[model samples]
Target: MDIKQRILASSCATRWFLFGLVLIGILSLISSEWLVPSIASADEQSGRYLSIWARLATTTGLVVFEVAMTTFLLAVAYLLLTPRDDRSGDVSVIEGSDVGRSLHEHLRTTESYWFKGRSARWVRDVVFPILSNRASTDQIRINLFMALPDPSNVKLMKEYADYRESIAYKGSKDTWTQEIVTTHILAAIVSAYHNASKSNFLNVCIGLSDWFPAYRVDITDGSAVMTVEDKNAPAMRYTRTSSFYSTFRADVEHTIEMGTKLPKPVSSFRNRELDATFVNEILAHAGLSGTLNGAVNEESILKKINNSGQLYG
Candidate 1:
């Protein structure tokens, strides 16, 4: 094995060794003090000292044994009852990036990638990387349904700005206003389209929807990862096998079924018309009608994004 593997193996071995020591020490104390004992008469002081020592040792050993046994049982229950990383749904509900790892391990290029979420943060961090690495086939389709920005109502916008400043953000609330967050998401989509290999076919459409629960569907010919939403914590991501890819794919199709034409792959010169149209739509969704009307270009779009979604136009 490699050095990293060897180190990991060694570390696991050390943990087992320590646990074994705890068990062995407790058993040895029980055997010496209770199972096999010597009775010898002595003075009262010496007898009292012996009695106290025996009780202390017995108590300590029993506590150690009980604690160790309980810990082992709890760990076993967690392993058996808790979800495995490899599968989801009726199978199991594994937590954290195990869902991502398991999907990557078995992911095939023919698999379709679908994501519906409030922000595309998980898409940018997890789904994009997985597809970029594993899927090599032509005609890859990514279906995304991201929450759209609130339509421009000055009162609502001000309220949202206050809520964002008060509730949802960490660090300086000034760092990312609601509109800035939407602009960043749009920028990510634009980047994805621009950077995708032109030789390989890629059809990705991001539709704007409101209050869609976040989930990702990555389906191979054999296996799939259908992320389960934790409603109490929408940010938490977990997945089960995709028994629902078809339904999800249909849902995504139905949203785009509004006759939204897929934008052509962006480039420095080619596909400017399609890019412009797509960017305009994205800007309008972010409540930036002023920037859209002022002849939205790359510079103006980026400027609004950098200036916290305030269109100076």
Candidate 2:
């Protein structure tokens, strides 16, 4: 047998043996007391044999009960600690081709389920159109060094931005930017759900940066802020600040309000991660990586990009 099988077998054997030992101890204790007293009226030799038999029976009963209780406790512990795997290892052949497809499909499905559809559609139709436009295409390539605990989050965010850009510049130009903004909102929602603690606040900030044309999102211990400078509209230049608690609370409240405003048939809460995936994918296609990291104290992302030289000449 394989190692896993061997291990399983050994564990089972050990458990049974322990149960047997417990039963033996219980039997010995009973035989020396209760069994011996019950058979005192019988001949000495007869009484001794009877008492021994009684003890053996009692021990067997005790062992069975102890083994059952131990098994039950072990099963409960296993269920609590084990991470569930939903994927089935079933394969089907269609036209002699393997059924397995690209990971993008998996991402798409996950996003679809997580977002509940609206967020996903917004990214595709709105976000991508804005980011991939040639007129603003250069703005999408700005680099903001991120210090995220999980690089996968950054990589995923980047891939989604690129994907959106590709779709936006399919043929014509005039890409849209609002889509990127919407994506940032979605990514924030997703990050908040996955890592609710303060330590992960940076990830949320970085993920939101993709939407801004110029600025980056920064998260410190106290609050989240945006910083930027606007050359075209100097009047709009200023640092914007919002507490992480306030921002998340506002987002949740806004979502709840939006849900309430929707028709009864569409008023269901969606998984934040799924919504984030849709937003990320859509924004990605548009060449927008809305605020995945940096300072959020700027008046506008465009202004920050211009001030920090995040945008190319």
Give the winner by TM-score.
1
Candidate 1 Cα misplacement greater than 4 A, ranges: 1-91, 97-99, 102-110, 129-176, 210-243, 258-262, 266-313
Model-by-model lDDT, in order? Answer: 0.45, 0.32
RMSD of each: 13.6, 19.9
Q: How would you encode candidate 1's per-residue C-alpha lDDT over 1-313 as one tens digit per residue?
A: 4434543556564465456657766766765576434322233436543567776776577667767765775464334433344223433444544554555554444445554433344455445545544434434553333232222333443444455455442333244354544444455454445334332444455554433333544444434445543322222223333434455556655654542333444444233333556566545443445523223355544554334321111
lDDT tens digits, residue span 73-151, model 2: 5554343333222112111112211111211122221211111111122222322223223113332231111211111
RMSD of 1: 13.6
Candidate 1, 121: how far from true, in Å?
2.5
TM-score of 2: 0.21
CA shift of 104, model 2, Å? 22
lDDT of 2 at 189: 37
Which 10-residue span in candidate 2 carries the lowest summed lDDT? 109-118
